[model samples]
Target: MAPTKKKAEKKGKIQEFCRKYLTVDFVKSLIFSPDKLSFLTYFILFAELALNILIVVKVKYTEIDWIAYMQECEGFLNGTLDYSQLKGDTGPLVYPSFFLYIYSLLYFVTSRGSNVKLAQYIFIAIYLLQLWLVLRLYSKTRKIPPYVIILSVFTSYRVHSIYSLRLFNDPVAILFFYIALNLFMDRKWTVGSIMFSLAVGIKMNILLFAPAILMLYITSLGYINTIIQLSICAAVQLIIGAPFLMTYPVEYIKGSFDLGRIFEHKWTVNYRFLDREMFENRMFHLGLLVLHIILIIIVAKPCYLFFKNYARLRTLQAQFEPQIAAENREIEDLVRKKMRKATKKADEEEITPEQKKFMDSFEKGMKNQFGDKQQMPQTKEEEDPQKIEIHFDQCVQLALLPIFLINFIGVVCSRSLHYQFYIWYFHSLPYLSWFTEYHTSFKILILFSIEFCWNQYPSTNFSSILLHACHLILLFGIIRKIYKEIGLARQVIKKEN
Candidate 1:
């Protein structure tokens, strides 16, 4: 009995030690570290790749858009004005001429035995490379959360995996936009500018980002550097566009800009928000533009003011000195110790621990006025009212605002949005979410839900419409929050107070 009791006590001690040191909690802490996010990112990307490959295998290669692209390639080879002529009135060459030129060349060169698969394989390669570029950009912008990056790629309602699987120019443009944003963030202005221009080469819609780029550059590098960067961007665009302007100027301009002047009969995934024919009228286009301008103005103005105020607060923090005498005593003691060590070191010809302590103390005191904490403490002045509001109940409101504004105005009113237009919405949604100020987890959850539906839900009659209406209602809620945060509600509060 004595021996058993002793053994039990020993085991308890061992278990206690393990609890303090080598326990499941310790292992969990390590696993949940920031590095885990990176691992998860790679895992998700790989899973997506595998799923897409399976999709390609399950569907016949000839049944997809790649066949249509092959027809376009044949037209280009035959010196036809339009490559999509093979589709007659049924299919259209919605992409720019450059898009057909590059792919057509690839088709002609690679067209042989098993070349159908080869063409699809080339696209798969491009998608993989583009995914890498997007991931790289996400890494560069540590300011953005990993979940936001994932949500943008996956849940973006417009960027269905099936749409991506189809042959489209959007993927190339998406890759270029990401590369440009990454380079711009890294302060590689010339490189980013060139990439941005190349993106425009693939699709002129990339020109929409100019305002955002200008805003980003202005904030980072100031006016002079922004001008220099802008010039470089202009030069690259001109160099690419000049040849087309010189040779086939009229056709290029007309086809690129005016191709969508008249709307054809087709239903979009978003048509359920309003009547099915909302896009057929030019008034819809004008209304959308007006809304876009208003929203941009509202967002941009407040952001500029808040940033300026925050900058001033930082400058003031640098100047303010702490007044605590307890902090100063340590510095004074260290100075005395240093003096004593200096005398001893003179005799011994070596620095002592006392000397090291004195040097470290002096450095610390120099950094913090009046020997207070060397690091800045979080304070009310440094905090913005708007940011605080965003963190709590206001998060969902912030997430919904840009989605409502952008989709209703920018997307619904655009010249044309084929199935590929979903890429623009999918890629841009999360960033727009950032503007709204939702919690990272909530944004990811909401996005994941939306994406899951689009990917898997049966597209039966009325189902797509119901989902779109649901989306519109969600957007409406978001807009209401934005109004409360930035609009007339604030004025009412001011008057009441």
Candidate 2:
């Protein structure tokens, strides 16, 4: 009896130690904190690298558009500059100038595009780089819960297939898009604009982010700067496309930027339920376009209101709250750590203690992000002991939220989405999910359901319906968030009045 009691006491002590050291909060902090996110990002990138390399070595490379892309590039290399004349196995060249140059370079690099293994490796590099950039965007804001990173990276077989098994032009353009997004977050507006324009030159699909970008440019840069930015975008496109545009202006515009191109019915992923006739109907396409515009108009008001509220929130937080200043310090600390790590040699790297204090206050950092956290100033200026770093939330709202939101809406509305198109918004899925009011489980369900739908080859009617349903659910969730934010602001204003 004495021995048993002593054993039980020992067990109790062990339990207490576990409770203290391995609590749920500790796990959450380790996984979800912004400062810890860098470690996870690196882990995922390396894992993805291994997976991509393995897939390239083990799985046979599927030739889809590579041959056609190479043929088109070869024609250009053969000095056939006429956009109207160049043809490949699939069809005429539809992508813009950047596409031509990229594949042309690939053609030579991959031994006239015959070295499939080497090309696959190159694309794997692009895929990894793109993932890194995407992770950087998410990290800059650290808005989405870090676990949502799994939803973006690990779950989607299609994304893996798109990047590795089949080398699509989509990944290349998207790589540039993400790079530009990171540049925007860094406030390099001019260079970002150029990269974005170059992305557009690779694929017109990138224009989905244009409306939100235009809004960001105007608001952030003012009229004159906005004009200059827009001009730079145009100039990049014009300069890259000069070869085809100077000689075959009409063909270049009609072929490369064709918005009215009718895709074959069998290839449709998003609209598989529609019969061939309905899918090809000009009226149906026109209706979708109109609906797209109407939804954009509806979302426009909420965006404007959110922006206004954000302005008020910023003003109030900067003046009245000591909280934001503290939050600024926490973020600045992380940024400084990043700078140090970026430059630090492994031997020179300093080992740091766990930041349980900052982790404890993590949720409070988002206080001003939603509309309900505003408080009147004490008529006293905030006295910051340290230089207040720019808020991650501000950078997020400035570049990420609206841009990602608008592009997502476009994805939901797009008439046709091939398998390769999945990457266009795969990284943004969690962004949409978190921004919405969906319960966490439901958010996961919607994300996985969409992934399940995309994984279906020759997408079935059921999958198509499920995909559309998931899209609508997300759209509604976003709309609800917009209204809820505005509604909260109105209530605050009423109280003030």
Candidate 3:
């Protein structure tokens, strides 16, 4: 009878365990925990796919740069290596050689770019690739809410049109940019650097992200590795431009990568408030360039401080490593001594039933708590949790914050921004918005107004001014958030006695 009762009890326990774990609700709960945001991200991505297809089917493909792109591709396909001779309807081939290679392929694919609808569909694929990269990038960070993604991808009428309708080369660079960012976040610094360089080869505008990217390399890979990565970037550009370089090096140099290229005041989205003369002034461009540098440097203060603090933390840890090890050893010795004494006492006496049960429970709890934690950390990331306040994930977040902020700085101080250029920073707006200390309404309103500015057929003075105001306010909010969240400069190293 006793045996039957024990067997029945064990069978009931097993049945309960199966019932709890194998249920539909349990599986749903498991899937929904932690990665709920990632699930939401994918759902939104599919919706974006439907939305893009609808846009392509319903909306007209407006010929903006597609004709010019095809013409440039025609010149290149005719075996023209000299960038000076690669003329489009818009202008000469000012973009790097890779642009030719990319557009040349497109040229062939869409019947020498005559199939506008087919090309629009391709752009839809390109736009989604970039967007998926952005969403995946956002997923790696823990704090950013999923709805912020809607603002980045969904809320933009102009961005949707820029991608599915106009088919600009900007989305290609933007795609590579996000790809490199995702790689960087994954700690594949070498491959990430290559992708980053490839992005820059597509468009010089991608250079706006360089300051943040370089600083990230410096912080993560150190100065020497960062210099090597810089060399890698230059090498990628040179290698891509090799044919043009061998032919008319001067023309390729001046025509492909001329930094002093003027922006047409007519397409300007951010500076209609300024006179045409002032907007296109070389000195004004220079001044904006200087201000851009200054602003990047200013916003980059937190990264510098983080690097400094990280160095100090390493130094302090080195000085205290011996002590930390000794303390750990003492702890291990004390635990062993206690364990030995308890075992010897139990062996010496006929232990009572309660005492034995209590000992077994205590032993199990101790092992559960401390057994896995006893091993010393071997990585440089966090040698001792007691000593190192920051963890690996925190370091990643710190690295990303400065990069996003620096790019925003560029957008704020840009000499001229066109409608298509909105894709450059639109995805980042949501990330930046959540970081700021503003109310949700203010952030949404600013974003809506910015969207309104970008969507306007001809950008007005009022829209441009409002765009700047929103940019400044958002910038201030993010800066304040960073200062509050990561006050590494003020972080003091406490020496344990």
Candidate 4:
């Protein structure tokens, strides 16, 4: 009896300790609470920056294309805009005039092209700016949570490599991309378009984002405004290209916009399974073209449908405002009464299965009909003025979907994928996570797979395919889920009417 009592006492103490320190609320308070989480965010950022600095100091020289960048910068400084004679491992200075002009400014600070420290410092500043812009964009939109910011800051090894080792123009391009996204979210459409144009100028790969941006502009602003904004964007690109066009028009055209340039099989990191001869086959290129066409259609169709349905829903809601409001009030009252009863029952004892079922049904109906009440515009005047209303999270999800799909498809059809290409998808991953409903272990597995593929010295064809395939599955799943939710919403609205 004495031994059993002691054993019981020990078990009770363990349970008490767990209740005090290991409860979900306790863990959530430690990590998910905004104030405590902000500290974690800062610590992660500081640690990443410090580690990157240390790596830069230790390596002292990068093995990638920094030398080529410096050569282009030197050529620009020497007033030799023609890059026909200047070639790098990736071929030539294939970037636009604005990139050359921007790189040339480094001449003012560093005399030697081999000054890796100076280059790293410049890139560190760019990285810090990118981080700040990301945080500001998320905070302003109120779309992503604090945990996402932490994930972005910590899981960005590819970005760190770009800044510290590769020293590519990608970071600069991404800086502009983030700034443009921020501006677009803030409704500074014209300036955002110009910034996006500049991003495309720095690296043509940034054009992957153009379709989505165009759709967003057209939907947010009317046709005339969108056209004007696009014209301004085109004007910015032309202005940046003008000097190069005049000096060496043929070379500028070939270098800046030549989409047909084929990389060698030896240089191909992602398509090794095709082997040397098969990598250069015309049939493969044709297949890629077909794949690109299919992907474009797939990505665009849903965007169009979503926009159309969203517009129709808004119009219908506005037309039946009185009826919708009455229904909403009735439902809200019913939900409150049910909630009160549930709370009273909970105070007395555990909720019955029937009560739980009713609560679940009530919540689902409420969500399908009106979304979260907090997300609905409070003022009737404000609600009526807007043609369409979308929750901030939904808005972000829609805006990023096209870009994510395009980048994924680009990777699928790409003949060559390098570690540096990870930039194309890295920024979108955290946002994509918001739409996914994977278990914690599954999410961790996905993260591990991505990191593993990226860390490979020369990415194997299988790993490349796997990484891209994983993203495709996730994106398609989210897209399907979104449309299904929209369908449910429509049904609920129709029923209410």
Instruction: Find the candidate with the highest TM-score and give its number.
Output: 2
Decide which is better by TM-score, 1 or 2.
2
lDDT digits (tens) for residues 362-430 of candidate 2: 545656464456644577644434655555344455346667778888988888889999988988888
Off by over 4 Å in 1: 1-35, 62-65, 68-94, 112-114, 140-160, 222-228, 272-278, 303-409, 412-417, 428-445, 452-497
lDDT by residue for model 3 (1-497), tens: 24545797799999999998888976665343423456676678789889999999987777879899999889887898887888878888788888888888999999998898888889888887887777676665655655556655677889899889988889998888888988887767778888888888888888888877876677667889889988988899889989888889999989878988888989999999999888878888889889888877666777666554544544455577677678778767776777687667755775667887998898788778899566545766422223323223333445566777788888898889989899888888877787787897888787888888888779898988888988989988887777775654355433321
Query: Where does candidate 1 clash, by residue pair?
Result: 398-436
Ranking by TM-score: 2, 3, 4, 1
Q: Estimate the lDDT of model 1.
A: 0.55
RMSD of each: 13.3, 13.5, 10.5, 14.7
261: Cα error in model 2, Å: 0.5
Tell me the TM-score of each prediction against the true structure.
0.61, 0.80, 0.76, 0.73
Q: How does candidate 4 score on lDDT? A: 0.69
lDDT values of the candidates?
0.55, 0.82, 0.78, 0.69
Q: Write down the worst ten-residue block by lDDT for model 1.
A: 387-396
What alpha-carbon RMSD in Å does predicted model 1 have with respect to the real structure? 13.3
Order the numbered candidates by lDDT, best leading.
2, 3, 4, 1
lDDT of 4 by residue, 340-366 (tens): 876677568756678879988987887
Candidate 4 lDDT trough over 10 residues, lowest sum: 381-390
